[model samples]
Target: MNISRRALCGVALLAAVNPLGIHALASPSAPKIRVGVLKFGTVNWELDTIKHNKFDAANGIEVEVVYFAGEDATNVAMLAGDLDVIVSDWLWVSRQRSEGEDLTLAPYSTAVGAIMVKNVSPIRGIPDLVGKKIGVAGGSLDKSWLLIQGLARRDHGIDLGKEGDVVFGAPPLLSEKALSGELDAVLNFWHFCARLEANGFRRLIGADDAAKALGASGPVSALGYVFREKWADENPDAAMSFVKASAQAKKLLDESDAEWRRLAPVVRAEGGELEVLRDRYREGIPKRPLAEEERDAAKLYEILAELGGEKLVGEARQMAPGTFWAALKT
Candidate 1:
């Protein structure tokens, strides 16, 4: 499912109904948390689940979801206090913390990503990627791209950028290029990978594979819900309520295919594509929020440092303390 289309649908729906206006007229009995989200991202599904199921209302908070066109826009809004929370990666959380932003992360999903190729292609593993044209979804500094680069060097003795021709673009474009034979394989975000597989591509390796090779104790989710420290501090109960609602939605995704089906329109998936997406969501959902020590921020810093060098994380091999928002667990 191309997430952008679904995001547009969400925006259109929001515009038509004026959810914010409706919320304003409702009884001002509950606290409100304004959440920033992307129009065409996976976060939309989870947020929609929470809204439709009235999870936030059940938890005594009025959830207001604000939409953005891209990450930069969402980041700016969050920084400007226009949003109380947003879905983002740990790297961004770390970078923000390094700059003294006092943002914290709670696990959203652990399903990192995967590299995919045509089923008939002879590229059976990452090792076989040498000298091949590979498509990457994000930019050169994208965390998954860097992790794959690091893993290729550490586990396969290959520097993918120097040894293989890497082309970076949007996930949908990468998938199109790979399918058209312009690239041998593509490393894409999980949702894009699921869409490609539904269209006949095959997974060569997953980000979890790279993490395992990097010595993680278990699966580590790179994405999470990020919020300002001050906001969380002032509204601790509301923050926990948000986390609890999100966790409930995650559980529903993990346990019920019916829930996925129910969310099909929100995610823009149907039939076999819906099933593939459901399976991917199940595979990516984290079992729990990461503990402070369990986050392994140091190892991630090392991987980013190795692949992206000073350009990504500067001279640091460890992120600032309080990056993982461990209080959610407590």
Candidate 2:
């Protein structure tokens, strides 16, 4: 779907307040950064932290949180100028740039999902998944699913999608099915995978490991902060401040268990599940240098292109230049 600067798309949603009291507008003195987040996305944990602790105010901006139901809604809200920023994959940014859109992405998280199986399941590797039911979240062309397919093809010459009985559904539903023994294995989002681990599921393989086998340098940022390039150029200070505040929020989350305790209900996890989510989230914080990340991202994009084909990448055979914001702090 080609989107011009003025034209946007849509999805519907309802809103709810997080435990942290939300400040919807900038104070009379501070510049505002309108951020659109999925109503229940993991990104909200950090956004909530930033707002609750006044990190944005400290960094010289106010972050006004807007809620969206899905990526399409966030993309639309962003293009319509209702939001200054949103979290999205760099591939989408690359495709938009290739199509002549002036957009860029800042690294967010490297938390790719994993392939999981029941603790007693016989599936030990990609090959063992043959003839078993595999539940996949994010549909057929899901990036993690595609990576596992690429790895399977590269290493064992089998297409799991064709060999296994594949089931696609929402993450929560799939997680439930996997737990109930209705599915023999699952490839799901990281948080869901982490939850499964807490519930006795063993990871068969991680997307990051599959990516490494296919030549990615290390953990790749599957999602990031995306925004119009013009906005960043015009409001350089606010842009930089948001980045700094985002980093500070991540540092805090990484260091303080008390903060996680505060965020527990927000993420809807507790006991072992909450611990798994916290540890996995902290481990996902992007640590690779930007240049190295960019290179690895480019490599991963090529592999993804081979696996997902044109429908996924939308006309770019390679990741476009300037796909990642060049000004990220080292």
**Candidate 1 ranges beyond 4 A from true positions:** 1-27
**RMSD versus native structure for model 1:** 7.8
Error of 1 at 119 (Å): 0.9
Q: Over 4 Å off in model 2, which ranges?
A: 1-27
The numbered model that scores best in lDDT is 2
- lDDT tens digits by residue: candidate 2, 96-177: 8999888898899999899999898878888888889999999888988998998998899998989999989999999999
Clash number for each model: 2, 0
Put down candidate 1 lDDT per residue, 96-197, tens digits, no spaces.
Answer: 888878899888887777889998899998889998999888788887777777888887789898899888888888888888889999999988898889
